[model samples]
Target: MKTFSNRLYSDYLMPSRMTTHEDLIRAAQVAGYTQTSVRDFVATLRGGRDPQHKVLIHRHDIDTDLRTARKLFDLEKKYHIQSSFYFRLSTMDIRLMREIEEYGSEASYHYEELATFAKRNKIKDRADIQRRMPEIRDEFVRNFEWIEQRLGRKLTTVASHGDFANRQLKLNNTEVLADQALRARCGIECETYDQILTDHTDIYISDRPPPQYYHPVTPIDALRRHRRIYLLTHPRQCETNWSANTKDNLHRFYEGLTW
Candidate 1:
């Protein structure tokens, strides 16, 4: 608990190390890159077309904090830049998601069906988790169809969401898409981690583990240096308020203890 608290304190309290999503996007523009959503990015690749200009594949996994996600949506809209926002079940807000789509951005699922199944069923053994793959895939399909039905559109892409249960069982949510047969069954054309995408991406940067200290170069510097970039962010990482961060930290801490 003490270790977690200190990490949160340093991460949220140190404003000097903070870099807003705005900072990174503006930097990309200054470096002569046009931002594109994951949906468009995948389509471009599959179409056998290569962009003539520098491209920034901007994506956000809305794990929590709907308000912060909106904060990002507003910032992106202000610049007339369209990016992808992948919503987990926990952060699903159909209205805001539709608003984002109306503004020309892509909104899709950040799925964690495997991790969720393992946690809820108390299935700890790796083999047991593996044996239940079909059930997990069914849950994923159900959620995917549910979201698509509500959004009133077909979803072509999805991104796997990670969780502690994934680590404990050495299973990934992406395992649901491990077979091409299943991918075709689900009608998902692409996932964020597909090698067809990652192989083409020149650099990948994320706000996880706090990019400020984790990366040797800041995101702005990365943009200046690399031509093709995949930028992933979580809305929770954008919150800078110490009190809110501390509250979230403790909530997660106690939640983990119970788990």
Candidate 2:
């Protein structure tokens, strides 16, 4: 394990700037890209149709922070933009999800059922997970419906969330969605990684790749080159709060010890 001093040094080097995320959103709008939520993006491309204008699909994976989620939510709202927020079960907040929908944005599940199941059952083998696919699918359905029932709206899209178990087990939460029958039964129309959207997407940029936590090319530069783009961010990684970052680092370090 990395020592406490090393962890602190690494955390201090992490780049998290909310203003950078905000700047990208504003730049996309100015560049004539219509920012839309994943739900809206799917609806627009329904029935095998093409979008009439340039589109910027913006989304946030609310990994761990509700405060950061609201900050990003408000920032987009300030510019009259509707984006997507995929909430993990860890950070699920009904009131905030309602607010997102009230303002014309999407608040849907950021599913990690497979990972959750693996950890809970302590099953790490590929065959074990494959054999337990039925139960895994059921877990996903329950979670999906749970969110919808509480949010009081139908979910048109879902984004698969990754976790430590997923990496260790060499599995993805998205595997559950591979069952077309299950997807139809659950009324899921689009996944964040659905090929339909990926085919239309010319490029994908995200506030990922630790420490810096941003794409190499700025959103403005990318917008100048691509007509259809997918922009994803995690508010916790993008927020400009040194104290919150310190807390996050500590939490991660604790998680590492247990894992």
Candidate 3:
């Protein structure tokens, strides 16, 4: 189980995010999660056998980015990886969401909803955000409705968007779970890594990297050590073109490590 330091780097940041799909497959073969399509991923999830590969795919922020949606769909067709796409539902690309939803790729809400709701569509910085949680979530119900309307499907799973820069946004893991749970009570079913693991102990679930914090040690290492490893990637943040910091971060984490 090598660390996530030296992952084969490819991103869909370009209109051509899928050109490296083969490279990624080869890399996954090297990492050993040789899954090539959605069924393979499902089998990993449903079967007792561990996944045969350790892989990560990044799509670069699926907001109005239809290019990413289309490209990811195409690549998923080729590789059989039923990866997850995270969307910033508040300011998300609705058109892109509509397009991506058809591909059978699972979608998760990236909670920019809090910032959009709390700030009254006006707040922008972290200090203002942290100082305003009560004032914000208290006043932000519309944002939730907005998200529900946009996705067309109710959001059952959510990942917090990296938001410290936008609002002094500190999320308590439990608090986030509770907030999501309240929504679930209304049939929204918002679940996170902790919630899934705590409730579903019989199933071998993959909670490798914590949401939005993608240092890939556990996930990649998990792949190496376990037979049924699962890996996830972000579409909006993993390419060199989108954010050099994220690229460098992944490169450093997976730097010299090989499968």
Candidate 4:
């Protein structure tokens, strides 16, 4: 958590070329995601309406989420609901990488760099931590490119896999990263950051990042609290149902939020 805060911020992020994959797929069943599109997404925020909500397209054990995603896509086609699917190269099966591209949904690299670094960097000095940003970014890029070359998928977005507590990376907020992404013509998309608030962008709601494994308020409650929020849910973890070694690290929302 302490190694990522020193960055030039958003230096590597590129504009998300594809529509968010999972949201587009779940949009059919997700009256909320679809509802916003139907209403042009403006009304939700006009009076602080929590409009955007999403399901995580995560693949924990692999296979199941991929197969399920294919089925979900078919259902999406049948239901005429447009959604996006974000796949993690680390978690998703490479065999389905083409499926992700073919689906016309987004393919972003979810870097586990912080998880690896946090375990390694135990020092307590902020200045010392800041020195590690460039190396960390480089490491992430190399790994990102490796995934792209192997998958033959153009990965444009960058998402931190675990909660990053790097006070030195300078990525704790949107303005810093937004300026970087603005310069690079790329940016972070909190498509599903906290669904309860419906405000995924750091600009609208930049509260403290929740501790890993903390579910906090339910999506409905979070949405009630902050109108603009992103809901992060893993298709794979949901199937696991929080089993041992499941690594249910990110925030979670029960089924009722969408229901």
lDDT against the true structure, per candidate, is: 0.81, 0.83, 0.45, 0.39
Clash count per candidate: 0, 0, 37, 35
lDDT of 2 by residue, 187-211 (tens): 8999999998888888888765444
State TM-scores per candidate: 0.89, 0.89, 0.54, 0.48
C-alpha root-mean-square deviation, each candidate: 2.6, 2.7, 10.0, 13.1
Q: What lDDT does model 3 reach?
A: 0.45
Candidate 1 per-residue lDDT over residues 1-259, each given as its tens digit: 8766657655575453224677777878878888989999888988999776799988999876677788888888888898999998877999998998898999999999988888778788989989989998888888999999999878888999988878888888899889787788778999889888778888888764543543445577777678888888776667655554566667667646655
lDDT computed for candidate 2: 0.83
Off by over 4 Å in 4: 1-89, 121-126, 163-229, 241-259
In model 4, which range of ten residues has the least summed lDDT?
6-15
User: What tens-digit string does per-residue lDDT give for candidate 3 at 124-188?
Assistant: 45455566555545433455567667678765545555443232445432233345535555354
**Model 2: residues with Cα > 4 Å off, grouped in runs:** 1-16, 209-211, 240-259
Best by lDDT: 2
